[model samples]
Target: MSDWSPLHDAAIHGRLLTLRNLINQGWPVNIITADHVSPLHEACLRGHLSCANVLLSHGAQVNGMTIDWRTPLYNACINGSQECVNLLLQYGATLHPESDLASPIHEAAKRGHVKCIESLAAYGADIDYYISHLGTPLYVACKNQQLDCAKKLLQLGASVDQGKGLDSPLHVVARLFSGELVHLLMDFGANAYAKNAEGKRPVELVPLGSPLFESFLEREGPPSLMQLCRLRIRKCFGIRQHHKICGLLIPEDLKHFILHL
Candidate 1:
């Protein structure tokens, strides 16, 4: 944040009047600190919607990236500012970050910022967008124990088994010993016996007496009849056709059940 001008301070602090005055004096709205932190970046990072509006209206780079590759939209999602997110999107902010480390969708999922995740998905973000280090957004959500995000991703049709390489979301959840997450992923059709690069199953990663271990042990063989039925119905609909299931003439309860709502 070195070499930051008063504009940066005004934006980060939500100082609308001072921000306007600096702009009136012809201060560059797009000026950056040595770290490539722009006033617009500051405004959105702090959820200062008014300051963000002024900067964007005066030609701030909507997609301006920091030295660490963080965008204004990425910053907004990190802060869980749905208002700022909408404002940035209105000005044509790119939903996908160039760097997977700072992807807006995955970042939101990690923090359990369900509204931000919903907005990103509604705007056509790749729900299964994969990063080499972080795996898919669903894996990130599971790794962070963000149950709401994991469910939301599933509702949006994220592939349940697509984790980092062969390490599925179930692996991350089981490693954390979270039985709730384990059941959630299994219900969504995660592979229980999935082997990571080291050939470790999720069950082997947890303590023997742990609830997660018990759950994993009980999951041997094919899923129960009800689970099989659910999986079959979803398979017929497929991932792409999931959204259209709501329009099907099925019973309301059946639709909700199938959608995992």
Candidate 2:
């Protein structure tokens, strides 16, 4: 590993005073490691918000990418640093997926960082940004067994069926034999009978004697009319307008049900 510079050390340790001194002494705030990892990247990745602020105030590039194409914003989300994420967004970091295989939302979901996911969603990161290896952010959340993050994504209108190829989110969780996750996905409108590229339903992928497999087998047939209606309404709102459901004059219980709160 390349030795981190004094500036990188200051940022990593959250020593804002030392970082400010270096900046004042004309040290380049954007100086990077051999892998092109900058002080800002280190600060954000370490969740050192104050140090990151100092670097950003000194004109550090918020969108600078590492040698492998990960951005500071991506690092912030990977570290679950909501503070750093907000600052990076405020300074104009690109919220969309660039050349990197994983977007900021994808990183947050992969790490089960619900707060970071919320911050990214609040800032308009595409909730459905797909990476072939990781699938959509929702798929990554499920693959990582991030139940809370998966729930949050569903509430934000993430498609529960949009995994890579035909490996629907349900299929992935079922293969893991997580009955809880499978049920949760179903509640969010996942189609239990949906087949993968191999033309197999989630139930068929489970271990032969697993209770999860039996549960999926017993849930045969299509969703009920009421369930289908609710799913359709949820999709109509989608991620961008789901929050508006909160303003309706409906009763709190109804509102909660509609928004999956």
lDDT of 1: 0.89
Q: State the TM-score for model 2.
A: 0.94
Compared with the true structure, what per-residue lDDT tens digits does model 1 show for residues 52-89? 99999999999999989999999999999988998899
- Candidate of highest TM-score: 2
User: Model 2, 1-261: lDDT tens per residue?
Assistant: 245789999998899889999998988999988999999999999999999998998899999988788899998988999999999999999987567574888888889899988888888888888877778988988888999999999898888889987899898898887778898898877887788988998888988877886787667778778778778888877776888888878789877887777
Specify the highest-lDDT model's number.
1
Candidates' C-alpha lDDT:
0.89, 0.86
Candidate 1, which segments miss by more than 4 Å at Cα?
Answer: 236-243
Runs off by more than 4 Å, candidate 2: 1-3
Report lDDT (Cα) of residue 15, candidate 1: 97
